[model samples]
Target: MATIVETAVSAGSFTTLVAAVGAAGLVDTLNGEGPFTVFAPTDEAFAALPEGTVEGLLADIPTLTSILTFHVVPGAVHAADLTDGLKAATVNGAELTFDLTDGVKVNGATVVTADIVCDNGVIHVIDAVLLP
Candidate 1:
């Protein structure tokens, strides 16, 4: 299996997310030996943001890193590990609350795809980007 970065690259849908990760200088960190649970947002999700939002974020490295890291939670947390009202701490020190009422959601973004296992971690594709 490929690492999270490799898997995301191969997926193609996470272009914006992958680019953002690279821009944030977090390629090595995400490729490191980790059991991270990533709430990955797709290009569509990124595009959903208001005009200039993505460009503004890409220009702000610190903010980009913070927002990106906020989507990651340490440890390999699979879909099965999640429960309604469950709160998980992100790598950026922020917290994400889970809502299982309508499928699965983290923060307010719906988990459109879940349990994408990778070499270093697992990924749950979220329909919306989670902001910290």
Candidate 2:
């Protein structure tokens, strides 16, 4: 299996995500060893943001990096392991809250796809971009 970054690139729907990761210089981090649970947002999710949000973020490396890392947790937490009200610490140092009560939400984005196993981690596709 490919790494999280590779997997997202292959999925094709995450073009914006892939580009953001690159611009944030987190491609190597996501490609590193050990498990990571990423709430991968699709291109459409990024598009849903207010106008100019994406461009503004892309221009700020620190902020962009923080937002990207906010989508990732330290370990590979599968869907079954998620509880109704669970909060996990993200690499960005913020806690990502889970609400399984309504189809599994991270922060505020709903999980559209879960448990996409990668070589060194997992990816859970989210509908909206989670903010930290």
Clashes of each: 0, 0
Question: What is the C-alpha lDDT profile of model 2 across 45-120, one tens digit per residue?
Answer: 9999999999999999899999998999998899999998798999989999888777989888999999999998
Q: Which parts of model 2 are misplaced by more than 4 Å?
A: none
Q: What range of 10 consecutive residues in model 1 has the weakest lDDT sum? A: 99-108
Which residue ranges in model 1 land beyond 4 Å of their true spot?
none
Worst 10 residues of 2 by lDDT: 99-108
Give a tens-digit lDDT track for model 1, residues 12-107: 999999999999999999998998999999999999999999999999999999999999999999999989999999999999999999899898
The C-alpha lDDT values of all candidates are 0.95, 0.93
> Candidate 2 has what TM-score?
0.98
Residue 44 lDDT in model 2?
94
